[model samples]
Target: MSSRISGPGLGSRSARRAAAVTPLLLAVLLSGCSSGGSGGTKASSAPSPRTESTATATAPASPDAAAYRRWGIDKPLAAPPAPPSAKLTDGLKPGAAPKVIRRVPTSDKVVFLTFDDGAEKDPEFVKMTKDLKLPFTMFLTDDIARAGTGYGYFEQLRGEGNRNSINNHTLSHPNLRTLSADAQRREICGQQDVLEKRYGGKPPLFRPPYGNYNDATLAAAGGCGVKALLLWEATMQINDMRYAQGDQLRPGDIVLAHFRGPSELKGTTMTKMVANMLRSIERQGFTVARLEDYV
Candidate 1:
């Protein structure tokens, strides 16, 4: 949850973007959220289905990336493997220039899962992601930690495999636009230092709280070395998911969720919420892929 902590083991998860902006854009714009559930959200749009060579994963022919083969995927991705990333661009490098991105531009039927706020630290959610071998990303806020350091669960996530990327949400979940420029820097750059110290690398990505940002926000983010200001195309709740453009899933969407537990979700656990999300993804014939690999 990125909003206020309502109670122990409970926090408010917000996909509550700028109420002034449209949730779904007729075209792929720099829009930020879909709808928030107890889970995640993504951003982007397409008039029709797009093709992605990177959408499929067969038995990994290489030893380095072999973990892709063990995915406990529900059905065949039913697509061919993408060619090697010869000359593939790496959009995740620090200081790459900050641009608002609703979704990755690709033809591959791969989507990203990004959970914001470090609120509900659920051990079972960690196990579920490991068991499924699903690759996703995390946009974390420091103040929302559940226990000592509030980072143990994420450390646990990192230890399990090489499938996820950690990003900066902020020190506290505040609308950067509401604060002064230096305060904004403290919010953006301050967390950059904290996350780097804790996670061992500076976060190259960032997502403003409530999908709220302005020109000053982006400027502060870029000054603090953020490469991309991420938004979403879909949002996930406890029981189901929401879309930006239409009811159908489009290629290259980045789904958003929160690290929440039973307290915030009408007594539903994070595992159940994730299960519903996976069902939605499978129903759409899309596969979960490493967000960093294709960016």
Candidate 2:
């Protein structure tokens, strides 16, 4: 037989203990449910391992990565292959008018960067090149190089390495196609003398002003000790590139740009223009190689 305990005071000690413990047990269950809900929320909000791994994989990795970022490049440029022991002259003869070269003949994924006219003298460009160890060739006109502090500025750009070569552009940047042979000789040979004296050696390369050249221009360039008449497959502007052939960059293509500043670039700095050029180059899966290396 069972008896019913109706009042709190009428219950046994064990029954009273259970009666008091039941409220605490309910409180603990509620608390655990609340905590579990919060834990689920946190787990959903946290980043997954796959997301983290993807971020790590896409980040630029190189000693100069920070420098590249500073200069507006997304990644550090690929280092060029070591220069060949025997320079590739592409069947260029020693005595005749130097062979005209629009591109180096090589299978390596490389292009040459050549800058013409020392018009803009930005000190920061020197810092950028040095910071990145970029290699390029300069074809400086005498009038522009001698103007103001341009000569010293280019000297800073030449630095202490043989990677940056100073070549002849001409005395006054006249269109060689319009000039007589004697006149062309004065333009090419005269600037040759200036560059040799100022830069410490005779330049072995020459680029005709405005990409304009004739047989007389080549003959005069050879007379002035030019070994090759360098031309361009692409010209880099402030924000875009103009290609002589297709819209794409080709292996060993020579790219032309100028030492121009905001005045000529629609208010873009020379460094920014160069950074854009590099971005274009990177998009094409190519890196800059020293033009002096293969030519």
Candidate 3:
């Protein structure tokens, strides 16, 4: 979404279009891409399940165009696979189960990209997802999203036809391990109420800050209508991701990012961060999936 980047203006449409070529040729390397990790089951080496680019999607107009080569994506954007037919949630109730989840259990070449907090609300990030037609899962904290009415910014993303889900982090980005179970429930459920009032539904997922959680965190999440306590296999940085296992992205991994702006990125931008994420996925042969769909 990464094979080449030969010029400037990586943020410009023209620059992205300039680095055009079919990247499916690298699909064969997916089998040898990465070793399995604790983050869900390893995804299959095959990349055909999520194929969306038709034969008519000729050169220059590819949906997976190198428009984000500066961000590091070297492959065309392929749609993610549909919800798996069987998984951990097969017999569980819709609104509840499972504590301290790290990732889904499937061999499909699918990973979940989740953004946390709600710091920077960049319009360009919205434009980037819209322009690229990519999808992601958001675990939003109340204080951050409410800053300067930044909730409007997230609304813009939804208004523009992006179908990403919004989940709860907490009222404040607190470390739940230190809080009592009642306090944790308030943090988790308070944000759930706020999100449902704003985004139209209670979030099915909940993530503890810094991946910190305990037995109390799980019990609190269940009481607040949260079905899963999500964790991650990778945390995205300004330019690259810190993987829990090997350097490569394993299938079924859940990667984390933030709604940050330039100041937090050491003067870089979130758009660039996301672009590089797509590039990494391209290089590894994995497509992004909807987190709620899997759970």
Best by TM-score: 2
**Per-residue lDDT of 231-282 in model 2, one digit per residue for the tens?**
6667776676766566888888888777766654567898998999899998
Show model 2 residue runs off by greater than 4 Å: 1-63, 90-95
Query: Per-prediction count of colliding residue pairs?
Result: 18, 0, 12
The candidates, ranked best first by TM-score, are: 2, 3, 1
lDDT for position 78 in model 1: 36
Q: Against the true structure, candidate 3 has what lDDT?
A: 0.60
All candidates' lDDT scores?
0.60, 0.65, 0.60
Query: What TM-score does model 1 achieve against the real structure?
Result: 0.72
What stretches of model 3 exceed 4 Å from their correct place? 1-75, 94-97, 159-162
Q: Taking the tens digit of each residue's C-alpha lDDT, what string does model 1 give over 34-95?
A: 22222122222223222222122222222222322333334433332463352122332444
Q: In angstroms, how far off is 69's CA in candidate 1?
A: 17
**Candidate 3 lDDT by residue in tens digits, 196-287:** 78756677677777666666776677777775666776667655666766787777777777676655455678888788777777667788
Cα deviation of 132 in candidate 2 (Å)?
A: 0.9
Q: Which ten contiguous residues of candidate 3 have the minimum total lDDT?
A: 7-16
Candidate 1 deviant stretches above 4 angstroms: 1-96, 146-149, 159-161
